[model samples]
Target chain A: MPREDVMATETQLYTPSTAAARRTSGLRLSRRRVIHTSLTYALLLFGSVLLMVPFFWMLSTSLKTLAEVQTWPIVWIPSNAVWENYPAVFQKTPFARYIMNSLVIAIGGIIGTLIGSSLAGFGFARLRFPGRNVLFFLNLTTLMLPAWVVIVPHFMMFSAVGWLDTYLPFIVPAFFGNAFYIFLFRQWFMGVPGELEDAARIDGCSTFRIFAQIFMPLAKPVIATVAIFAFFYYWNDLLYPLVYLQSQMKFPVSLGLRMFQTANAGVVDMPKMMAASMMALLPCVVIFFFAQRLFVQGVVMTGVEK
Target chain B: MALRIRMPKTKMARREAMEGYLFILPWILGFLIFRLGPMLYSLFLSFTDYAARGAPQFIGLENYTYMFTKDPRFLDSLRSTLAFVVGYLPLNLALGLAIALLMNQRVRGITGFRAIYYLPAVTSGVAVAILWQFVFHKQWGILNAILSVFGAQPIGWLVDPKWVMVAFVIMSIWGVGGSMIIYLAGLQSIPTELYESASIDGANGVRKFWHITLPMLTPTIFFVLITGLIAAFQIFESAYIMTGGGPNYATYFFGLNIYFTAFQSLRFAYASTLAWMLFAIIAALTIFVFTTSRRWVFYAGAREDA
Candidate 1:
């Protein structure tokens, strides 16, 4: 049965070696390829549209009037787009303050992660210490440790230090290095040629000097990857901010948006809520588009290379 | 000359070790103070009756006992979270792989399609939740509008307990683009020679995909599955923002329960217990996956131990 099936397929795919028959078969094969490619494109387009519906709805709702948002037919396009909703979001809540808070936290996180992760990663990758391998292994294990386990104690610890309601919790630990980013940096640093470090040492460079000047400069891609991850983590984080920060003014955009939604629940101010969401979403989306390559590299590195 | 060289070599090695220690000092300090200290403290807290007021009175195993035997929300939260994991995981993996396969085709403007798909993954989780909340609105949602176009009645997505989990799953799948990118990377890394050889053996497209592509993609699938499982278990921000743990606690995820217990109820010790339970569940499942992975995950050119 298998032989017969194979023979049938073979006959169907190709005719016996006459030049004219071969030419017709070749045409048929090309046509088949064309159909296959077209089908792939069609499927992708359909998936893309389905995937993008939420985003499209967000944008569409943000531009619509409140009346348009609640209309029966679900207006795909508002006849009179409410461009004022974007600016009005700032007026409605402390949206500007939220954005500012988010930026500060994000920047602090990026700076801290870069410094801490790079230094620690460089140490693990390049230097020999007594318990280096054990320490590195511990770091990787912490990657699997759930954040929930540490959160309550962290809250207590911070409150004890009078650091609650501040950005200290978010920013301080970042300066100490994250397990995943440190791992990423270590992996990248390990790949750097030993010759460079040797040359730097021979030139009378201190270890710190070699790291600051040579390794750090050469790790731009990994640095970009780490920085982007840190930025997004701080910017988008809700649970941490929710647990730690108490003051409304100190809230990041994430917490602020949640507060906004909670405050306006049942009222359903769809346009203004969507406008605020769009604003909150803007920076990360813009950064992603600009650093698309680095993002993909970082994601793939975490998944495939790990 | 030999004595002098040996002395300097020893001195250099010592210096290198000292430098390594210095570079990684921040990480060690952070790990001890932030991670280790908090983890141990939380464990202690889990056995106490701390409420963020005054002193934590030790009340060993009461929290754990209460969770298992008495606490009304505990089982509900666990069941809801597991239901979400069950509903969300397979669909996410399948859809992510499907999109990745489609995006793997050598079609023109493929990167554009990829970027469009991935746009949502980078957005703030809070913002995405808010937008989705609007999209799932019963009376005026675009989703119901689309359904209406097909002569279907409006379904109360977020409002109805029966359909809430489905809504959450659909929202989660919208961001499947992140996994799709990883799968695409895995797909590209596959050696085309496998496909070429399969074709030479008269293997059709479906056979080639099953025999060659699926086996080769197992490692990536394993990676996605593990990470996705971890992330899914920690489903908080979306549920918190979108449903506030529900119309009637239908979306009361474990993370939300932990948060409410810790903050709202001010049962810091009990929250710690809940947190540890979550950690235990995650760890067990992770180990389960790791052990099972040996049978399925394939690595090209990998050593036996690896």
Candidate 2:
């Protein structure tokens, strides 16, 4: 979510003429310049190694034997790789079901956020209304109020409707448009030239049809951005599930992973724990790698563009 | 531009207003039911002793009074959260800016470096807790192993009460990539001409940064500081999963305290008080930041050119 600011700056930094000029300027690098550049790379490489160690350790330990994991001097490599630890995570708990639960919530959240926020964004951006400004202000106010503020009442309200321990609480809210996403969509929609909507209207298209056929089709970038953020949010969310869900069968991978850690607190089964952590983290890393550009765009839309 | 034929202005305006409302209906419903309704209900619940099973028993300002005067846990939670904020926020800002400045250098393969740094932000929450537990394990952990190589005794990172917050702060700083990204964006926006002119005036790298870079990046820093503090104050999942707010509640952050109070103790009203207190703190802090921003946050215009 934070990378988009870099994109905003990058656009300014890397315009064709400016980039060309900078490239030409780089060609005249002196011995001092070369030394400075090497120093910069060295510092960055060192920092990157420090940052990457935990991840490297996670992968390394996941393949280690339980005995190897606890060795003094911290065995950098396992004498015997425990490839079975990955499957053991599933064997020790309902890890597969937990993964399924996480997918359901994350996907559900993405769909709801896309539909709800886009429509609301289209409304706030294009459609003229008497109370539009007021409504949008109200929407922005949600950003100031922490989610925990309403959590108690939300739990009670959901419980009253017999929705506790179900995915309804997590999924339903997404269907109603998140404030930040709505703002993102509104900003994106606002940037779409008014001429397109006007041309569509001239062809006798209704407002909803104009939004669905014209604006929605052109909003793929924003939609993808919202989807990635929503997926990230629901996938890592532990507090909501902790409060509202009680049954093991209903738990998402996040809650399930935490429970796994707590259940095995007395045992030093580091390899299996690392394996479970890896399993839980895999989807997000995959999504991030694939849609890296969209992720950066999302951050830009929310941060610098604001 | 569409259908510019002489339709009555009033009819057209009314139709557009209606269309806007229709498009935004989902958000309005969501706001009223999910956000506003829950907020007001939570406010009401804050004044009553409402267990999950029964009706709310109104008890005036007792909840507020009890939190202020009698609750040692509340104060402890507040103090711990503040300690976390104090430790985490400044380091996050400084490191974020430093890494950003480093990353902002015209270095090759910088994107690859960014992707590596951003790995932690995406793979946070439960996975992070599990990984950090292994890293900070009292004995035979990788961190302790490294400390031993330096001829230093291994510190009990997550065990000893004095050091748990420091451990959490370290974990928090590990994901500074988001803020760093934002800073890169801010740095990018400082017109290159400004730097060229500064260099012309005999400014070195440090002088250019102090004069040109710092002022221009103030807006981004302000944003990061506000959001970072807000996020730190709500630190819960890691504390809950890692130390379980333990070592005699030294790591008991306000969010976890509210969670335990509501879920474990089933004291809904008291929890609501805690939640409101959190909201108040965040809101006050945010407002304070915004108000104070005028003094230091350098907007592009509406002032004298520097």
Candidate closest to the true structure, highest lDDT: 1
Second chain only: TM-score per model? 0.94, 0.94
Listed per model in order, the count of residue pairs whose N, CA or C atoms clash below 3 Å is 0, 1
Instruction: Tell me the whole-model lDDT of each prediction, alpha carbons only.
Output: 0.89, 0.86
Per-candidate TM-score, chain A: 0.92, 0.89
CA deviation > 4 Å runs, candidate 1: A1-17, B1-9, B304-306
- What is the C-alpha lDDT profile of model 1 across A204-293, one tens digit per residue? 998888999999999999999999888889889999999999999999999999888888885368889989999888888889999999
Worst lDDT 10-window in candidate 2 chain B: B1-10
Candidate 1 colliding pairs: none
lDDT string, candidate 1, B1-306, tens digits:
122222225877788788888989999998999888998999999999999898999998998999999988998899899999999999989989988998888899988998988887777579988888878888888899989989999999998999999999988888888899999999999999999888889999899889988999999999999989998998998999888898688999999999999899998999999999999999999999999999999999887774
Q: Residues A1-306, candidate 2, lDDT per residue (tens digit)?
A: 246346545755658676555445546546578898899999999989988888888999999988887767789988878899999999999999999999999988889888999999999999888767878988987877777888888888898899999999998888889999999999999999989988988999999899899989999899888888899999999999998899999899999998898888843778899999998899899998898778777766665654
lDDT string for model 2 (B1-306, tens) is 132333336988889988888899999999989888888888888899887667899999999999999999998899899999999999999999999998898899988988887778777879988899888887867777878988989899988998888899888888988888778777777789999898779999889889989988888898788878778888998999888888788998998899889989988888888999999999898889889988898877667656
User: How well does each candidate superpose onto the true structure, as a TM-score?
Assistant: 0.94, 0.92
